[model samples]
Target: MSDPVDFRDNRGVGTLISDLIQQVSSLMQTEIRLLRAEMGDKLKTMLGGAVEVLAGGLLLMAALLILLQALVVALAHWVGAGWASLIVGLVVAVIGVILVKRGTSNIEPSNLTPDQTTNQLARDAAVVKEQFK
Candidate 1:
């Protein structure tokens, strides 16, 4: 017959195996936490860069709009018919709207949700293709 197993002594290997399992679990949890922290830091940096780029782009757009408005005003004054000036301003405004819409539509935000990004890209592509034709 096989020897009877001892239940009360430290010599049994069950305790050692349990300790090893626990150690491995703790290490895994630590690694996961570290990975999460690293990913969060990288996301923060990316978002900050995106925000800076967006701010700069908006500032440039504002300056361009102001310049366009000044040009429209000067043209209106030089042309000298009240109705003509109104028509010219309206046409310029419409053209400006179209250009701005096309310009901003091309800007892709990298951090958008996957579905939103895909949908926006598909829509923009369709619009651009239609515009080209």
Candidate 2:
């Protein structure tokens, strides 16, 4: 009877497996880096929007304050008492404080991510599954 051929310790099996693992690991790392980059881009956009909103809000507040002061000055002049302007300024300041309090209470920090990426991926996977069906 012919001796059974030994197939043990095939040439470069370990090296091949190590190379494959390295390739897969590198690919996974690349994907993770891409995700982080996308997240950073989203965050930057959100920051820009927040800055614009802050500037606009501050401008509106300043304008409101100016109008309030004008109204106070006019009222004081009408009443022939310069000291009455201080009362108007105080009232406006109180209203501003209330608004600031309410605005701050409603604010919450957020993580910005693109909308529906996971859902789109799921849909794509379903389509692929259906193709095999």
Candidate of highest lDDT: 2
Q: Output the TM-score of candidate 1.
A: 0.41
lDDT of 2 by residue, 18-41 (tens): 876786577557656666777777
- Candidate 2 positional error at 37, Å: 1.4
The C-alpha RMSD of each candidate to the native structure, in angstroms, is 17.5, 11.4
Q: Write the per-residue lDDT of candidate 1 for residues 1-133, one digit (tens) a residue.
A: 9798666766557876677568657755765565566556656656665555565556556656655665677676765454454555555555556555554443445432344334544665576467455
Candidate 1: clashing pairs of residues: none
What TM-score, computed on C-alpha atoms, does each candidate reach? 0.41, 0.44
Over the full model, what C-alpha lDDT does candidate 1 score relative to the true structure? 0.57
Candidate 2 colliding pairs: none
What's the true lDDT of residue 122 in model 1?
Answer: 69
Query: Which candidate number would show the highest TM-score if scored against the true structure?
Result: 2
